[model samples]
Target: MQTSPKPKLLIFDVNGTLLNMDGIKTAINQAYQHPGAFTQWFSWLLQYSLVDTVTKTYHPFSEIAEAALQMTAASLKVNVDAVFMQDILKSMQQLPPHPDILTGLDLLKKAGYKMVTLTNSASAAQKKQLEFAQLNAYFEETFSVDAVELYKPHPKTYQYVLDELNFDPQETMLIAAHGWDVAGAARAGLQTAFIARDGQALYPLAKKPEFVCADLHELAVQLAAL
Candidate 1:
């Protein structure tokens, strides 16, 4: 088994990493009247987030989600209006964490691991999301990519967190459900734990994550042992 020297800081990715987006998926399906619109919308949201990063354009995550929803609605020949998009955005803030989250996070907290969240969601939305999910107590800090005007998968965003927390890359472990995020942290020099949520897969060319667990519960046990 691979064992890491216990890290000084554990930085988590929000969204699908810590929180469940099943509600948002249901919302999309209901609004678009299409069973597959949810998946397509999420893919487009992530795609355009990177597009903005690569093209030097910046928009808050909520805006990107809204735009993605409109595009998804249009593609499906569904006349989803701005009001429906706004409702979706509001629902996003109220999502619950995955079922494994509470026990997993509690285990880490009890073990004296310092935890924080690093998210693409901007400050206000990030706070609301965490608070709504009742996850605010587990994290010591919540960071957003907006601080550096770059999103995850960009080295600057990771560096910004490390810099603010006064921790070296080697002293940190980035825990995420997205392979692209794990790849980014690996490139930035942090150890990574990939939570292989259903429908998520690692990139073939990306560096292997130092740890791979089926969910946060499994990850918690491994981290506690370390």
Candidate 2:
């Protein structure tokens, strides 16, 4: 496999990449009293993200979460208070990182790579989530699509990270679990790494990433060799 020179900057996606949000899925199912409640909300979240990107409409990630939850509740024929929905959304702030994340991030830092987090989440929630995970110190910056009023898979969202960091896409590597995210970054000219967190499939027609690893630690080792 071809490898570029050492990366000057490493960008990570939050959900399903560093953090395991399966707890949120369980919470959603429990709160809605339905087995598919979590899947429903997740699908709606993606839908709204696409809508926001295409329409140039923006809402805080928390608001999107609440709105998606409400939609899920309505579809399940259940009634939930708006305040209660907000509480559930706030629970996202308490998610923890995967087992390999901190150690992998430590190794990357020791190898002298600059690291940042890029997420589609709102800034406040992303901060809270990282702080709770105790991995906040590993990153020099946390970027959210909230700044651009768009979501990932949108070229502008990835461009926002490059613009803020003032780094060329060629020198930056985007590490993500979602195929769409990796594909978008690759399209934007950033080298990409695919972390197979849940055996999720990549976009069949998307530009393939430079590397694929089972988890963050493996990705770190591959990067260290570059």
Candidate 3:
């Protein structure tokens, strides 16, 4: 690990890191009523988001999610119309914060670390999510890939924040629960910390983040020592 000075800002990935996705997962699983529908749909959501970036196209994250759900429905021979798919995805807007989110964010806030959000979701949806989760108050600013019409793990997305937010890459830390996210930040020249949420791990081929923690609370504890 590299010894670095404290960061000026913390960039967070909202979907699975701060906001728990369990509610949305349950909604998808129940709507499809299949054994692994949620997992499959979620995997496709991620794949299509990256596909959007590679193809140089952009759509709101919810649209990609609905498309993924459509694919899952077809694969399982379950028929669902656009309205039903939309209804199922509304669960995403209502996801609750992780149990330790308040404590973790509060610690960072009191310690004088500036915080912000960088999400793939559209600005409107991101607002709804944070409001619903009651986590909107902690962040100083919120960013969406929509600003640049790109998705995460794309260098431009990280760069956009650095430019628009006027922060040095070395002075920003991207904290996320997904391996691809931390890897992306590391390659972007920003510091990173991997929150090892359920079933998440680091990519062996990518530059590793400076910190690997079990959750945001552990991240606070670890950063406190530094």
TM-score of each: 0.97, 0.94, 0.95
True-structure Cα RMSD, model 3: 1.3
Q: What would the per-residue lDDT of candidate 2 be over residues 77-185, giving only the tens digit for each residue?
A: 9887777777777777888898989878988998899999999888988889999999888999999988888888888888898998899999999999888889989
- Residue 186 CA error for candidate 2 (Å)? 1.4
Write one digit per residue (lDDT tens) for candidate 1, span 84-152: 889899988888999999999999999899999999998899999999999999999999999988888
Worst 10 residues of 2 by lDDT: 82-91
Q: Output the worst ten-in-a-row residue range by lDDT, candidate 1.
A: 1-10
TM-score of 2: 0.94
Query: Which stretches of candidate 3 lie above 4 Å from their native place?
Result: none
Q: How do all the candidates rank in terms of lDDT, highest first?
A: 1, 3, 2
Q: Could you tell me how far off, in angstroms, the CA of residue 61 lies in candidate 1 after the best superposition?
A: 1.0
Residue 106 of model 3 has an lDDT of: 87
The residue ranges of model 1 lying beyond 4 angstroms of the native Cα positions read none
Clash pairs for candidate 2:
none
Q: Give the Å shift of residue 17 in candidate 2.
A: 1.2
